[model samples]
Target: MNSVRTIFQDGGIYIALYAYLALAMIVESIYDNEAFSRWTARAGMIVIVLLIGFRWNTGTDWMPYLRVFYTTDSSSDYDSVVFGIDQGYVLLNRIVFYFSDNYSVFLILDASIAVGAVYVFIEKSTRLPNMGVYLFYTSYAVTHFMGSNRRMLAIGFVCMGFLFLSKERRIWEGWPRWAVPFGIAATVHRTSLAGLAGLMVSRRAWPAWAVIIGLLACLGLGMAGLPFSGLEWLGGTLAQYTGISAIDKLVFYTSGEAELGTDVNVALQAALGVAKRSSVLVIFIAYMRFGNPSQYAQRLYNIYIIGCAVYFAMVGSPIFQIISTYYSIVEIVLIPIIFAEIPKLKVPYILYLLVVPLLLLLTALIPYLELYVPYRSIFSTF
Candidate 1:
């Protein structure tokens, strides 16, 4: 309890940003006008993008990223294999560097790619765009916008491809829409190739029983501190064949360096990790099965089931958790669909609201207050 209170006290501005978004989501539920909702989503998206873009010397990895961006030039292609940076990301830095030497401009461009694409997915595909955006900030904003900038770009593009999958068009047509985007995402970060699982989920929701059983199995396996020797071998093999340095990171993260491996009270942390994911999957899947959510929401829930299964099973492995991150993003859009249908401030609605603070509380106990508190921007003293 003291730790959680300390997190809120230290991260007042950071938590307040979340509070602001939450308030907007609540207010948005009161409006029925499509035009107003559309414009409000746009306005919120723009604000989020700018907030991420304008950061100066903020975020956990900004300094490292800034160093790499400055050095990334046309001559940096061969460095990609050595530094574990992706070739496409190198090219992006080189292109942006040549056009403008300012790192702030590069930051803005990266923010546009990462944060902007998810916003696009929510606005076009979800029933409650504001709720989706707010949900995104709870965990994703700090992780993606503030760190893992390269993988975030890949996730963003993959999300764009999911947009095509969510459409009512022929299934074959969806393949064509994604090939280019998925390829581009792979070039940015190879781990995103795991996102292919999304293509396999049918538009129909999976059976409620199957999802429940699968998640329970995952929870048990994850809590056991499952090892990943085969995964380490696979990463080594991929790096050998592809000559990509970044793929080697997979091996490092899984070689007994996962949080569960290093931390004391591993069982407690492991339980919390799986519990947070299970809460959403169990609760959201219940609503998805019983409620009249749109076809798009069902599709998102289906992918989430797959993501959660992997996430829960790999709670002890950080590399595999990356795959789950790709899948779990569907919640930003899927949860909003359910939230929009429930009566305002009713039991169901309040249950949905409970989901938002779960991740925030989890983060508060770990890296959030330490890394992202006292937010700053290039344009201000903060």
Candidate 2:
């Protein structure tokens, strides 16, 4: 039993993860019954534990705070400001770090987020237990990026915010209440403020002319060859208001290497850039063909998808990558909804199931393989 625990703790355990993912995929593909799905969901929980166990060696990004909490007389001012001192996580770490202050906690957190996300996807998706869906959630895009602990918390909260907005009873009354959680997330990670924008877009009704004017203005600004200067000025303004010099450092200047990182190929990146424009195109068509969504929920989803598309196209910077990632959270909800609603060709459905995961995996691998040399041993570490 001790030897079994030791083996599982070692990097050799990732092979078990690979096997688990493969088996889970097969099981999901073969069974569609409620009882079977529930069983698979439980198996998914087990896989989550294994995956977390594999991450045991990978250090938590927030471990320094845990050390400060225990060892130092300092009053956790740093923790308060940075959200490194949240009650739930701090207490969780206190207990876990007592045993082993290694990477185990991070793994647990990552696994929890992945499991929660998968559970949500499964609940929402109309398609029966399919290998593609499981594979999609397990892929690097969701598992590595979206499931990264702190970011995942922000994402999970944002997803909850979306859920609140989507609920029929809560739609009218939820906005005021939703701000609190959104604000908490923004405090933890300012990037989460994007979710607030998402909330606003989701809730409000905009005039058709107003949306068109906004698009034209964005395009005009992009076309005027002044976006860089505009971004710099905006950064400076933000820095002055916030008194954080880092704001001016902005991702564009600091993340040039990351923007040009190897994770995204020139061709695929170009394609993504092109696809960004499709939001405007989608909105225009959706407007012309089906008309605007009648409910606040559908309207919000449409606006978010379109807004992200345009934003990605206009700014192909690393900062926007974070924004793009958050936007894709909405896509997780939207894609399955669309697949269920649209009477598309069967081949397109099959192709979408196959190609999307392949594309996401390639996107995730390129960056991990090319830009992040230090973390390359992530696989080996597991």
Candidate 3:
């Protein structure tokens, strides 16, 4: 009892979220029935809601975006002007923000996205434990932070996009319809365009070597530090074609980072960012050793892993954390699917399920430890 108390006192909301998710995962693992699994899922949802509500009254990073949404005049000229680039997300936030100035709406949207993602996971990989899916949703860093809210929505859209790709077996469709949701998601956050690229890679009917080379090229760009000097030429070409400066602006946006100052913490984050990029190398090697995964899964995982590697190598920015965020989405679905394929490894299945989520929780906590520490006492106060 005292040990449990100590854990809570030390970790605060961090431990609370982890414990709730861990418990739910254990229960889902033990009970495979849909009804019971869903009950546990609802309980997890309630916990997320309660946590969001508690955090709402206190300030958090999401407050500013929520305020922008809630307080901004829909009829004002600035609404379209300020949000012209990422109109989809801005429009959604407007509707959500209309309800309240609190950031709870963001939490609600995140939870909804999580639930949708889990449903997609179950549909694609039915053998996965419900708790494991929920654990992945809760423990991932992207879901917890407000700064990446747009990316979170993009992840939700990615889930839907994956669902469409998975359904290709039934439909005689090529890529056009399938590409739309992902494109929309990309519009929500340009970072997600990588996911759409992944979808395209999955649908390719080419030989495996091509895929291998493509993955290598992505990694090489990171390691080689691909120059953007060509951006000026590319921007001019786009300007001639589109008659709009949007593409040029995007080029300039990414290019502008080169001149920005760096700090110790940012430098540390960059180093860790590189370490995280190495996970793509790990995933690629794992893919080669394990043999080709399912077409749809291959696309999602490869795209996600390559994006993480390439983005980190190029920018060395913490924004690359967005890859880790949604990659956990892929992990939840992929881990269980991979476990299902190896019946000979039955004895280790449960252990893998438990250990992987715990590892993800630890990785997610690295960035939050500083903020989480001062608030440890707050948990006891509750």
| Per-prediction CA RMSD (Å) | 3.3, 7.7, 5.8
lDDT of 1 at 158: 85
Model 2 CA lDDT for position 260: 47
Local distance difference test, per candidate? Answer: 0.72, 0.48, 0.53
Candidate 2's residue-wise lDDT over 319-358, tens digit each? 4445545545554444444443454443455454555554
lDDT of 3 by residue, 121-151 (tens): 5545545455444545444532343235566
Backbone clashes under 3 angstroms, per model = 1, 4, 0
Q: What root-mean-square deviation over C-alphas does model 2 reach?
A: 7.7
Question: Which sections of candidate 1 miss by over 4 Å?
Answer: 1-10, 72-82, 233-247, 256-269, 344-347, 358-368, 380-382
Candidate 2 Cα outliers beyond 4 Å, as residue runs: 1-32, 37-53, 56-100, 114-118, 121-147, 169-184, 202-228, 237-270, 273-297, 306-310, 342-344, 370-382
Ranking by lDDT: 1, 3, 2
- Model 2 scores worst on lDDT over the 10 consecutive residues at 369-378
Q: Against the true structure, what is each candidate's TM-score?
A: 0.86, 0.64, 0.69
Q: TM-score of model 2 relative to the true fold?
A: 0.64
Q: Compose the digit string of candidate 1's lDDT tens values, residues 1-382.
A: 5556765776565566677677777777777667767677667677777877887777666766777787644455536433777779878888998899998898889888888788888888765777777778776777666667788888888898788766676657757687777888898888888888787788788888888887888767765755355566776667555544556566556555434313234445456656667777766877776788777778888888888888777776655666777888888887777776766435557545656564654453354344555556786664
Ten contiguous residues minimizing lDDT sum, candidate 1 = 257-266
Winner by lDDT? 1
